[model samples]
Target chain A: MQASEFSRWTEENAVYAVPKTIIRVGQGERSTAIEGAVTEDFLIRTLKDLIEQGR
Target chain B: MSPLSDRDRQTLREMFRDLKYPVHLQLFVEDGNQGSDNAKVLVREVVRVMPDLLRLDVFERSRDSLLAALYGVWEVPTLILCDQKREDSGIRFIGLPSGYEFAALIEALLDVSQNRIRLSEKSLNFIRNVEDDIILDVFVAPT
Candidate 1:
């Protein structure tokens, strides 16, 4: 999906990069994001941290 | 005329050869939306190449309001990939999957068709144990 086509989403999410990844927890009320490509370990760790924080 | 080249179709056929299960693609579209139209064409062409492995169902957003809401689809040109049981895999491409995003779409289809998630055992375990809903919205550009 191209960010240009989703202008509103890009603007709201601040998607200024190629691979901006948003980790949205639950109904998108709480979330975290990464601006670039990340390793599986890093992503998993981030997810774990977010899960812990939410808990 | 097809948007994909003959070579592209051949490559997709080869890539889809390993698909052992069914992948259902639910595409939500609205009339007169250029992005929606493009997504419809691209998705149909991609699924055409792998009919044995892929199932595509196109829907009008306004006409299928209940289904759209059920699937949590609130946008035009939202392509949702599902497993054999028609269960959503949480993989969605919100616009036409073009350029680099096209490759990601192919990979996602393959993954869903094969029921394969390329995460480590520990990561998989953690995900499986998590009770809360997790959504990964990957924002990408054509370049």
Candidate 2:
């Protein structure tokens, strides 16, 4: 996800708060982690990066 | 008579001995409540395992009003997790912490005792930047 997409989505949604930290734990094929403290900016950035990665 | 069998009680007693911080399990029972007996039994079983971090404090309502209000316990079998410093973070369980929720209860207890939640780097980054007060209320069933 690119930075811009992350910003736009978070700004538009009021109910969904962006996470302060987005940790992708684990490694290789079976990696998993949890997101915490969602703030406005973090949500936008995360979404953008996700979209860019096509995830 | 204790609800737990002799074997189970012994195992619990050993588990609690290894804890680094003290734990308290305050069980609030209302007269004639359906699960009061069950709750008491569960507390006894838990105390037997982690006696160091686990304590069973029973409140009969008539004993003290201030204690109930302090814990915000309106119902029976409420579990409040406190840190090592004796600070209450306001994390509460309204019903029995069994089943999938039991895992959550264990994790929360560990977090309070250790003062840390193991997360990935990316997740940690997001969490560290959060300035706002975030209230996470997770609901689950005992079964």
Candidate 3:
């Protein structure tokens, strides 16, 4: 997929899985890799590179 | 106990209705990781409902340490999405992807199945002109 395609498709729709509720983790009772908008952005940028080159 | 209630299951079923290609959700679990158990059942139900769009590949860390380590998994209950050839898509979860993160699990599959990403033109440009190897990691912590 091209860069633009990668950007558009992933941002529009991103998927992930997690427990029913994220209580707390880490040193200061924080979320460990909380997945949401940040995750969508990450996936949007990351998927194409993986899908295209298998990297 | 089944964590996913009827409503949530229906929600997931609808969310994953339009996946274009098939996606394999690779799970790596070690002993004493209760999160992996919940995640396993959740994913099982999801794939059970959407048999065409998703598949589950499970590996015990002790049994599949080589493959598990390939994905940089040093902890239990790591979830990664794989393409048709079972290549990692760089979308990974260190802990159980539940609660709000459940959406991410579904979309990771959708993105791979469809082979698409949605980003701003600026982000796309950066991804386009990249000439060197780049490692991308996104972290979220409640502060």
Candidate 4:
């Protein structure tokens, strides 16, 4: 969502920067937030690790 | 007034000149909202530059509840990228894509049009082996 459009959402999520990504797997069972610009490799690794941690 | 400048329009036309497939932009908007209206304007301007490669459909969220639900859109001013056949490409923008986000929107359009994914080999493998429905909410400021 546009953080600028929703003050409440931005405050609740603590979106103090641009490109704050929240990744969720399987109906919100597991989720993680990554701040700043991330590379494709980093994102892929994080996803794999998050899934592994849930196992 | 057009949201895009003449130079920006020319650049977009050039960028999309090599598009091999048509991309559909499905925009879900709320009535009487400034942000939604701005989003509509920007998307319309972008599409106008490359009509041959882009198709746009605007849906009022309140009036098109079923269509919104079908596309899993729960927010106003959300833009979904789809194929020529109206298949979802799993790319979406949940607000007005201004500032830096506009560049991302353009990149997504290009990728969607070509059905291209520039991922690493390992990342590609991970995606291919994925068996779960994933939802990624990338929150961003316009600037």
Best by DockQ: 4
Encode model 1's per-residue lDDT on A1-55: one tens digit a residue: 3456578878888888769899987777778989888899998888888878877
Tens digit of lDDT per residue, candidate 4, span B27-63? 9999998889999999999998888889999999999
Q: Least lDDT summed over 10 consecutive residues: which range in candidate 1 chain B?
A: B134-143
State the C-alpha RMSD over the true interface residues for candidate 1, after superposing those residues: 3.0
> What is the TM-score, restricted to chain A, for candidate 4?
0.70
Report i-RMS for every model: 3.0, 14.3, 13.8, 3.1
In TM-score terms, candidate 4 sits at 0.81
For residue A15, what is the lDDT in candidate 1? 81
Error at B123, model 2, angstroms: 10
Q: Assess each prediction's global lDDT (C-alpha) against the native.
A: 0.87, 0.57, 0.67, 0.87
Q: How much does candidate 1 score in TM-score?
A: 0.82
lDDT of 2 by residue, B1-143 (tens): 65557885675455434466766656677666656666666666666567667666787754656888887777666767766666774567666665555556666666666666555677668667654333332122234
List the candidates ranked by TM-score, beginning with the highest. Answer: 1, 4, 3, 2
Worst 10 residues of 2 chain B by lDDT: B133-142
Q: Every model's Cα RMSD, please?
A: 2.9, 12.4, 12.3, 2.9
User: What does candidate 1's lDDT look like per residue over B1-143, in tens digits?
Assistant: 77799999999999989888999999999999998988889899999997877999999999999999998888788999999999999888877787788999999998998889888898889888988888887876556
Ranking by DockQ: 4, 1, 3, 2
Give the residue spans of candidate 4 off by over 4 A.
A1-22, A27-37, B137-143
TM-score of each predicted structure versus truth = 0.82, 0.53, 0.64, 0.81
Q: If you assessed candidate 1 against the hidden native complex, which CAPRI class would it receive? A: medium
Tens-digit lDDT string for candidate 3 (B34-59): 87777778778878878876889888
Off by over 4 Å in 1: A1-37, B135-143
